[model samples]
Target: MAHDHGHDHASSTRTRLAIAFAIIAVVLVVEVFGAWLSGSLALLADAGHMASDAIGLLVALVASVWATRPATDRHTFGFRRLEVLAALFNGVLLTVVAVVVAIEAVRRLTEADPHAPDGIPMLVVAGIGLLANVAAYLVLRGGDRRSMNMRGATLEVLGDLFGSIAAVVAGVVLLTTGFAAADAIASLVIAALIVPRAALLLRDVVRVLTESAPRETDVTLIREHLLETPEVVAVHDVHVWAITSGAPVFSAHVECEEAVFAEGRAGSMLERLGECLRGHFDVEHSTFQLEPAGHSEREEPAHR
Candidate 1:
């Protein structure tokens, strides 16, 4: 079985994430200062979100770099799963930030006669934040979104984009109507936007960590395809899972005709089975054990 080593893909993605992190880092500083100067909770909430984005980008960048390291005997997968772990951490961080923002927003909303937030500075700073997020989004947009690591970073940028938009709206409302609650309302909206995506990312990470089959692969269909091959009597003990995004591995035991084994055609049958898995199922890594019928009953099978 051939392994598709995505070295170039990982390298390019790392570069993009690094650049995006730099852009977001600058924006985070600006927003924090702006939040302080304007006393706008919306801007503060956006700043907090941006801080999480910066951390998420850093984790993604590290994972990308770690994923490229050569495999060792102790760690055969060679840090590939680091990406998934990073994504999990990012999701948790985002949820925590959202919770904190929501708590503060609720407090502001209920407090009587809150002072009007400074709108002019909030508007100016939030506009700059929006522009920065737009640039970050564009930079990270070109990578494979199927990768959990990239998706985590992309989600951060996406959330920041929405946060900036909400801050701008809050600034506008507070400026025109002297409504201080608008800032708190915008913070609440930003928190709401963060929950769904963070939950999705967390769910995906958990699936991978639990060694669940990828959502796209169907085990029943794979079993049928193997049974269709010539001289194959039965198929059993099939297993499929992903090593990482876009890389699936499979293994199964195939019972074959006695003649096929006696004639020394087992190797040919094995090759054909591998080809079938690769061509039909996009499974590039597979191992098939060819055995005569009843052989499984004779020997203790690892999986019945």
Candidate 2:
């Protein structure tokens, strides 16, 4: 029942992403035409943001499909990591887009010619775009943050929501004051707002793909917990990393005291230790080996 429920949830998420992608695509087309007609950079900037959102949604859809492929002998973990990779790519793409926006704003501000169009029409269009973005954001609100694929999409939605609001504000200000430069200035603000969030997502996804320890996991703390187990004497060569977003895998070497070895229950002791680790840390996958104090020097580091 639990497995079936999980499958159903995954299916629902895919359906939502598909719908959002369609909506964003339609909005992008409308905004592009609107910006062209009104000559409003703010509207154009929002359109560009919608384009990125479309790309992010597409990447998420592909990742979800790939994640369902059955595991094979050559790749035991199947294709789950592909989703994280896609998210990293999306983050990088967003960062680049932000940089371009910043550069364009600098040029316009220096030139002192914003080329602002009549503000009333731009304001109306921007307001509509903002409404669309808010709807899209709500659609993705139920996604699990632990899934980097879902998290990345959520971040993109948030960026679009903020971008739309900025464009609407700029349009309104320009319409009231004819401050043509307000549009360019809003573009710069939107760009700056997007950079840090995108960069943070990129950094986290890269760390997971590289097999670096998850930020929330402490190797020392994990080792200490193992050492405190009744029969364990020495613990070493511990490693921990994220299997995907929320799932974590841990492996380690432990030495049992001579007294415990005398009981001839090293295997059972190791089993209890595994349970303890899981119970304490919410770790789902573990590989632990037991050894007599000096039995067979510890092996080489485990490959990620």
- On lDDT, the leading prediction is 1
lDDT tens digits by residue: candidate 2, 1-304: 9889878878888887888888888889888988898887778888887888899899999998888787899989888888888888889888888988888888888884457777877788888888888888788888666788888888887888888889888988987888989888888888887888798898988889889898889888888888888868778777888868887888887888887778888778977987987899888789887777755354554322
Best by TM-score: 1
TM-score of each: 0.94, 0.93
Candidate 1 collision pairs:
none
What TM-score does prediction 1 earn? 0.94
lDDT of 1 by residue, 1-304 (tens): 1234466677789999999999999999999999999999999999999999999999999998988788899998788888998999999999999999999999988888787789999999999999999999999999878788998899889988998999999999988998889999999999998998899999888888887788999999999989999999888888888777767889898999999989999989999999999899899889998989877776665464
lDDT of 1 at 88: 90
Q: Please give the lDDT score at residue 56 for candidate 1.
A: 94
